[model samples]
Target: MIIGIDLGTTNSLVAVWRDGRAEMIPNALGHHLTPSVVGLDDNGDVLVGLAARERLITHPHLTAAVFKRYMGSDRVTRLGRRDFRPEELSALVLKSLKLDAERYLGEPVEEAVITVPAYFSDAQRKATKIAGQLAGLRVERLVNEPTAAALAYGLHQSEPESRFLVFDLGGGTFDISILELFEGVMEVRASAGDNFLGGEDFTEALIDGFIDAVGRPRGLSDKAATPALYQALRKQAEQAKRALSSNQEAEMQVLHDGQTLSWQINDAAFQRLTEPLLKRLREPIERALRDARLKAIDLDQIVLAGGATRKPLVRKLVAKLFGRMPAMNINPDEVVAMGAAVMAGLKSRDESLNEVVMTDVCPYTLGVEVSEQIAPNRFQAGFFLPIIERNSVVPISREQTVNTIQDRQQALHVRVFQGESRQVKDNIFLGELTIPVPPKPAGEISVTIRFTYDVNGLLEAEMTVEDTGEKHRLVIEENPGVLTPEEIEQRLRELARLKIHPREHLPNATLLARADRLYQQTLGEERQWISSETARFQAVLETQDEERISAARQALKQLLDEVEGESWL
Candidate 1:
């Protein structure tokens, strides 16, 4: 069966089209939200999800979380004894989710539709697909995360038409998209976002506040000294931030360098600390609305997605800016996965979702750098000439004409870039094409560059030299920061040797890791209580009595849940 996966920055989830409905497949721990964390055990086995997340506090040197921030970079995380690329780390998470889906479906799944932020670069998108390949699944399509959320929300409505905005704030990225549904077609009018802004930034704001108040602890100032201590403070800050989301005031304490550091923050204080980030949330919304050529009042609905939307200030900001209360009918954490499943079903031509026809726009402006001549013997380079503007409908072709500046120029170089910047240096260079031209006087030799951008995010350029009628075509696929075909094959061979933990051990391992993390976070009686509970759970695990182990694990999970409280997601 084909599945849809939301390979998110904070958490990952898998869903499938089963029995004419989109059904979320629970992980081995019976939880739909799997933390996007990976680590290696002492025995040299890979650990993912909650088990690995716990290690962020207990074994920071050997665990990596939030690696999604480096998807297109060459940065590597050293976990345990091995060094791994960001994509490699992501592959492990995808592989773990794949195993969960296989066990849930009782079959070997082969393909999936994965979702990425609408503003992800081409290199980032390709890296994600390569990650899927590394995990033994064919990546069929990469749906925009905000668009996916809209699809899930719009598919159920019988209304003939409507225009809605999707404000998606996830762990590490934010996206704002505008979509119009008319006559069974859902067309994305525009998308804009700051890839680096999201829920994590809010937590970091709190961290900054604590650091400013307590003075930078020596261990935290130098992460290499005590990585675990730094990670613990980060974790505590996150929890306290979530508490402030519901409670007017929240208290957090971190033990660092043999000293207890404590801080108390009310909702107003947290909001003030995160005001800069909250301010950034409006630009994307305003841009999306402007790009769609509509005002906030023109929108029929404003949909919220991603776990970060659960923040009270975020909702308040949306209401204040948009002059309306944002829609929250669907669970923010689960909606994207549900929409991805529906997209997967649509890709497979599932009958239930046949009526929905969705179209997405190019997220960035695609253009080429040109030299403009305003006077004789005077020229200016770095001028951007846009062939297709950002937010234009995909599967589109546009042509722009250029004249040779020098007399009898032998060739013209077509340099391609993607961005809205007027200067070529400010945009991302995709590739270039050199078209041979018949030497002619200045302004006599002209070449037309036709850019055909497809729905699959591929850009094809055709340069036609007007003098000789010679045409050169190039399919722009080579990009910096992405592995070549040979590199991908070699990397695949290297990754095959990596051994992830067996599925059967995941539940117990996750519970044990969480309890250990709690034990480390507490002090005095609470610490002793957690210590005894962890030991008891360990003893029960040794018995290997399936029924008894299951009962104890559930009880332990409940106790921890009560103590930690419900997560914002």
Candidate 2:
């Protein structure tokens, strides 16, 4: 059976369409949301989700989270003895979700429809597909997150025609999509977003506020706190941020080097701290509306998706901007997964969704680098000529003709790029190919370059000589950030060999990791007490007595709760 997966930055979820409705599938932990965290246990077994998240503070060196922000980049995150690219880290999360789906469905699931940010670059989208492949699942489609949300929302709309906007702010990315539904057709008018802006940035802003209010530890740079302390501060800041969503004020306290640093932020203060990020959110929304050629008043509704949208500050900003409260009947966190499941059902030709049709737009301009003649003989290089404009409907094919720039030029070099920049150097180079042409005077030989962008957002470029009709296709396989087929196969084999920590031991392991982290964060007496309790729990675990282990586990948990409260977990 085909499943839909939301491989999100902060969390991931799996869902399946059942009985004509999308139903969320609970993970091994009996939770619909799984933290997008991966780490290694003491035995070198892989730990994912909650257990791994708990290990962030305890085993910062062995754990990786928020790797989604680096999806299309060559940056490597080292977890334990192994170094992993962002895609590999994401693949581990997808693998965990795949297992959860299989277990929940009681069948082997081989195919899936995954959701990605609409504004994700070409390489980022390719990385997402590769991640799905690495998880042993064939990716049938890569639906844009906001488009998926529109699909889910469109299904329930009573009106035959309506226009709405989807504002998605997740852990590490934000997207804005303006969509219109008419006569069972859901069309995405435009999509815009910041790949680096999201809730995590707000958490960072709060961290900065804390640092400014309460001085940092001695010998530490302004931005260079130790990982453990940073993790601790992050946890507290995240919880406090969430608290500030409802309450007027929230407090964050972290223990560092036997000293307790505390900061309290009221709603107004939190807003002041995150003013810049809030402003960043507006630009994308304005751009989306402008691209759609619609004013705010024309929108029938504004829908909020993604976990970060739960913030009162964000909601307030949306209301102030649109002069209306956004529609959020569905849970913001599960909406995209639900929409993905709907897409999966559509892919499977489910009878219930036969009448619904959805279409998306290319989020960025796809173009080729070129040189333009300035004088009779003078030419300036590094100009960008767009083949397909941003927000153009897909699956689309557009061509742009260009002449050779030099006399006796053996080949016309075509470099494909994606961005809004006017210069080639500022744009993201997707790939390049050299097309041979007969020797001729400058501007005499012309070539027609056709770019085809599919519904899944993959781009293909083909160049044809105007006179000879010779054609060459640009194969985007050499990008260093993307894994080659052979590399993918090798990585697959390696991932297959890595063991996942047993599900039954996760509670104990999580508790132990939490205790260890708390031990490291506490001072004098508290540290010694945590060490003792942790030892007792470890000894009980070693005994392999279920009754004793359960008793000791509960006792240790209660002790930790008394000392640190439940917010940290």
Candidate 3:
């Protein structure tokens, strides 16, 4: 059976086609949304969703989430004994989701239709598909997140055409998509985003406020060693952050090292502290509106997604700026997953469901590294190559060719970039290619690069430097994930050979591997959190006594439920 998975940054959800409709599948936790966190024990076993997120506060050093923004980079974050690429880390989450769907359905589910941001680059999309492969699920299509949301919202109709501005504010990224829905084709007009902006900054602002009340916010250097005190402080700060949303003032009390201290803050005060962060959020919306050549009034409706959108301030700011109440028919939380299920139904061509054709946009610009002679500054640009125009219907392919400049050079260097910068250095360098060319004079040889973006936004690329059939005989295997075929095979074998256990221990063991280098400098309480939460989950495993994972999971849920921007952070 085909299902749609909204592999989100802060939280993830799954849904499937059944009984002539799409429905969300709950996890073991009895909730529709699961945190996109994974924790590891000392024995090298993994814990996904709730259990993993529990280790965040305590085992901050050993947990890493939201690596999605680094989708197409050379960044490598190390946790324990292993160094994982962003795609590999993402695979762990996807793999866990696959396991959950199978367990809930009591059947072996193999294929899926995943969703992505409409503005994702070819390399970023390729990386997502590769991650899916590593997770052991055959990704049938990679639909755009906004488009998927539209499908779930049913913007397609036989009536008058309408334009939509999809404002997606998820955990790690924020996107603004303008689409024109006409007939069955929902054409994307433009897309824009700020990868680093999301819900996390709000949390940080709250944390800073707590520190400010204590008179040392920038850093702890000014204080005389507040170790356990800081831990209790962070907890209270988090609580107060949540309280301020629903109340005029929030009071938090904590006892650490035999001292009881109280921190009090008002909602207006908290918003003021976070005003700078919130101000930046408007820039993306304005830019998106301008890019679509429309003012706020031109839009028929604005759709919202991502965990960050739940914040009251986010809602207020958007309403004030756009002068329109946002649509909330679908749960702001589960709409993406619902859309995924609907798309899967359409892709499968299930007879029970009606015809549902879809279309989406390219996430980023496809360009090459070029040398302009005006001072010999190297610039990456798409001024020439714009294959597969932005916001085109998916399952589409396009090609662009570049010429070699030097003779006797059998190899042509292909450097690809993703961004809107006029300078190549300003854009993201996905990777480079070295294509072998037949011996020829300078400017007489051309290399064609083919880029294909499918319905799910999965990317497949091909390059040929010869038209004479000499170098066109290379292999055409398309592996998009960060892990190569060999790496995926190796991981599968390792998992199969090991006696995987849910056995738990102290907090340290429960933190995910990539968190070590990330939050190492955290204080004792935070340091001990990983171990504490690990025990919380381990204790739940029937065979493991003195190991508990339940406490951590419950605590994580409690903490996250009250968490304003935890998912986006």
Query: Which ten contiguous residues of candidate 1 have the minimum total lDDT?
Result: 215-224
Candidate scoring better on TM-score of 2 and 3: 2
Give me the overall lDDT of model 3. Answer: 0.66
Work out candidate 3's RMSD over C-alphas.
6.5
All-Cα superposition RMSD per candidate: 2.4, 1.9, 6.5
452-491 in candidate 3: lDDT tens per residue?
7565555556777655544432222232334556766886
User: Per-residue alpha-carbon lDDT of model 2 for 1-569, expressed as tens digits?
Assistant: 99999999899999999899999999876789999999999899999988899888878889999999999788998887788889888998998888888888899999999999999988899899999999898996999999988777754355888889999999899999998888778888999999999888999998888887785444333644577777877888899988897899999987665566777789999999999999999999899989999999999999999999999989999999999999989999999999999999999999998888888999999999988888988999999999999999999999999998788998888888999999999999898888889999988999999999999889888889988988888756656598889989998988888998887787788788888777777778998999988998999989999999989989998999998787331
Query: In model 2, how large is the Cα lDDT of residue 318?
Result: 99
Which has the greatest lDDT?
2
Error of 1 at 334 (Å): 0.9
Q: Write the per-residue lDDT of candidate 1 for residues 1-569, one digit (tens) a residue.
A: 78999999999999997778789999987899999999876677889988888878888888999999999778888876678888888999999999999999999999999999998877788888889998999996889999989977854364688888899999999999999888778899999998899888988888778777663644345433468877877787888878877899987788776788888889998988999998898888888888999998888888999999999999999999888999999999989998989889998998877777889998899999998877879998898999999998987999999999988888888899989998999998888888888887888988999999776566799999887788899876566766777888888998898887888998888878888888887778877887787788889989999999999988888878876764333
Off by over 4 Å in 1: 216-225, 436-440, 468-470, 523-533, 555-569
- TM-score against native, each model: 0.94, 0.96, 0.78
Give all candidates' CA lDDT scores.
0.86, 0.88, 0.66
